[model samples]
Target: MAREVFDLSFSNGFARTLHERALGDIEQDYPWQSLEPSRYPPLLLARARVGWTENAFNEFCTAAAMGQMLQALVQARAPLDLIGMASRFAIDEVLHIELCARMAMRLGGGAPIHYDPEDIVFALDPSLTPLERSNELVVRLCCVGEALSFPLLSGAMRSASHPLSRSILETIVRDEAHHGKFGFLYLDWIRAELRPAERDRLGKAARQTLDAYRSLWERGPSHVVAGVTSEGFLLEHVRELGWMEASAYAELARVTIEESVRAPLARAGIML
Candidate 1:
């Protein structure tokens, strides 16, 4: 017999919140570092700086998505525990911004990052029903987006030599594990009620997200950011920094989806 994904009896027992012990205080536990400025090359430092900016932006995006999801859940009368978990997840994203920024400053210094406020808000077509909109958003952002972080960060951890970076990265990996699991669980909870059309909607969304990801990865490191194009950078020495080379990262991403993500979705009858 297959295991149940969503606990139908969740309300019977109290739902657990985030592991406060593991997380600790963002600043106190994950202390900032002051490494020798000369340790990293100019390009490497520049890349780290870019990482800070990108991760900061991603932090806000994820937080914004959390708010939208919470609103949708309330409108749909979702479990209070689930909403509580999401609220906490939004806080985690904030810590991630600090972690990323610290890494950048340690590497070199933070780059100028200007983000438009409008870009942070979530929007869906007027036609989408509450359930439909929420499902698609969760499927795209959490299921696909946060799910991918598992493999990507795991791969990085394996190659990462720096003790401080690895420690911080592990927290993100731990937190994202729950995020990905929630996506699958939520989908499973709604699985029996889903019409063929709803499944198709989610299936299409997943496919599109995966395709965009593959396309982005296949484009090489030059496609990663501006003024930073070390194509095979992560193949050797840079692996010390906890990232993969262009070819390896792309292949890893594709393989991980095929194994972990795509297979599971197909089994769940999502047709991805």
Candidate 2:
């Protein structure tokens, strides 16, 4: 498959107007002018740009996944309230994508990334029943993925010294607060109908998603932020620019997986 450039854009006229209304004053008073890009080394800025670009791409993928979840819920005849909540989350992800992309531009410019457009997300298995498929989707996307991200984002937010960086992380964390718990809430509503075998399968699915994320953080160090000396003091400015050090990032990943993901998943009867 040919790799295509990963990029983002928006339409003009009424479409954009409608998007703005849904987003609601997204860029207003964001402390954008406070960014001191000059203080960081060029290499660090370039890395930050790539990091944010990766964030934007991941958000786009999540939005696509949300669409799949929303459709699955509706097909399964889920409660109207759950469907409505999923609808809202899809838009929230779009806003996040824009925010992350803009942050990349703020650092310098978004780094070039190539991806197979055909493979944006893990496709829902068609062999399963509607409700069963919904369960798998929720477990993977919300129970594991979003649950893992919430605390990691919080850690980055805490480490961010730059006001603009902190503000962006704060906004993302706020929007995603519900996402982390969405899986458990769905399970609470639907668990009575789930059989032991189905629960076991969902647990495996959750583990697959968890392992996917693990592979990312464990892929050694990023080329741009590769070296982490014993002191690790040189990356302090980079952290203010909205990145955790490699070690701190991996540690937090472990913490969130244990406390946030595994604990709740076991309670929900999908132990992994």
Candidate 3:
């Protein structure tokens, strides 16, 4: 017989409230103000230009994926509460795409906002059951993707010379944090319902999903930024922000996955 599932209403409510609160905190704290973009070297400015465009492209991909995943969840007849939370998250992601695009343009970079066909194809594959799809989606979207993104953005925000870029990154970080929390909570809720064998399977799947995206957080675009900036100053700035140190970032990944993804799952008796 199949294992019984529990209602995720409370988890959904907690996630919604957390996201809402994060949105408000972003409006209030606005942590990006410390970086004065104009103070950076000219080469650094050029790098920021490229970075903004790349950032916009990444956000567009993320938003597109989240929208598709949310649709899949709704189609699977996931609890209404979870569906509603996902709906709001999808909308926020869409707005983030637009916001990042605008920020790129404002920072003197042309928008490179092409959506990859593969992103949709991977997101909407009909081969997997709903639970399988959700697990894959959360592992990639929340745990690996958003989990790594926060620290990267925070680092960029710290090194940013442009005030607007700093502000934009700060806002984006707030949303990503909440998204990470949702991934954690979902893992917790699902782990409780899984049998030992299933837990092991999920753990392996989670680790594989995470390992697949390891390159995304590998290193700064040092060479690329060097070319764009015409000097190594931007690269140095990135180094100052700790992007050059793989050890530190690797540790960050380990802790983020452990605390925000693995630990919660383990506590709920999930193998991952």
Highest TM-score model number: 2
What are the Cα lDDT values of the candidates? 0.69, 0.84, 0.59
| Residue-level lDDT tens digits of model 3 in 91-157 | 5765565456555444454533344356442433467678767766765677656766676566555
Q: Which ten residues in a row have the lowest lDDT in candidate 1?
A: 2-11
Candidate 2, residues 92-207: lDDT per residue as tens digits? 89988988998898888899989986678677677999898888888989999999999999999988888898988998999898887787889889988889999899989998
What's the lDDT for candidate 3? 0.59
* Model 1 lDDT per residue over 1-272, tens place: 33222101113333222434444655567545534546667777677667656766677678778778878877766667766776678877866766776676666666776656565655677799887877877787777877877788777777666766777788778777788777777777777888888888789889887775776357454343332435533343365455655566777787888776787777667877
Can you rank all candidates by lDDT, best first? 2, 1, 3
Candidate 1 lDDT score at position 78: 60
Candidate 3 residue pairs in backbone clash:
36-161, 37-161, 37-162
Highest lDDT scorer: 2
Candidate with more favorable, higher lDDT: 1 or 3: 1
* Alpha-carbon runs more than 4 Å astray in model 1: 1-28, 219-237
- TM-score of each prediction: 0.80, 0.92, 0.66
